[model samples]
Target: MDSGELEHPPAEELQVGPILLALADDNRRRVVAELYERSDGERLCASFDLPVSKSSRTRHWRVLREAGLVHQRSIGNGLYMRLRKDDLESRFPGLIQAVVGAP
Candidate 1:
């Protein structure tokens, strides 16, 4: 793995507990919701207009990455992220839609 890349669990290793915990945060969920709407491509971490402090945003990203909900890679001076939608769907069918589409 590249040194600039963050560690992410294998798709089959995605557990419900971690995923639920990560999504429990409104900020993280908001990120996921926005990611859900995007096509399959990485977006810069700064692109999300999250209403949180830089430290908090970092924490949210860590949680999401650690939970295997997203994959993050550092490129140049920016961090890029992409939702692990396909992985999540494969591990827990319909979970992404259920979470992002929830009322």
Candidate 2:
């Protein structure tokens, strides 16, 4: 959601270093790839079936959010996440396609 409760960097403030660092992890990359593949391009955080523990999953979400690769909002007890596609595209054209290796 646009008005997210969680703290994350603004799209304009997104940096290559943090985004690359966050994407370096396979699990985090998987999350990005999955998000990119979806037409709607949004999903609940719990909807992802990552191999890591719940705590680790939480950490991954933080990394992605902090990197400005994703936006997250709390809905009741669950968190909803979506790729910052338009923002990313505006800030760094072709970056997502190059990183995600999407066709």
Model 1 misplaced stretches (Cα beyond 4 Å)? none
Per-prediction TM-score: 0.93, 0.91
lDDT against true structure, model 1: 0.90
Best by TM-score: 1
Candidate 2 ranges beyond 4 A from true positions: 1-4
Ten contiguous residues minimizing lDDT sum, candidate 1: 1-10
Candidate 2 lDDT over 1-103, as tens digits, reads 3554788788889998999999999999999999998898899999999989999999999999999999888889889999999999999999988988943
Clashes of each: 0, 0
Whole-model lDDT, candidate 2?
0.91
- Per residue, candidate 1 scores C-alpha lDDT tens digits across 1-103 of 7666678998988899999999999999989999889887468999899888999999999999999999998888999999988888888999889999996
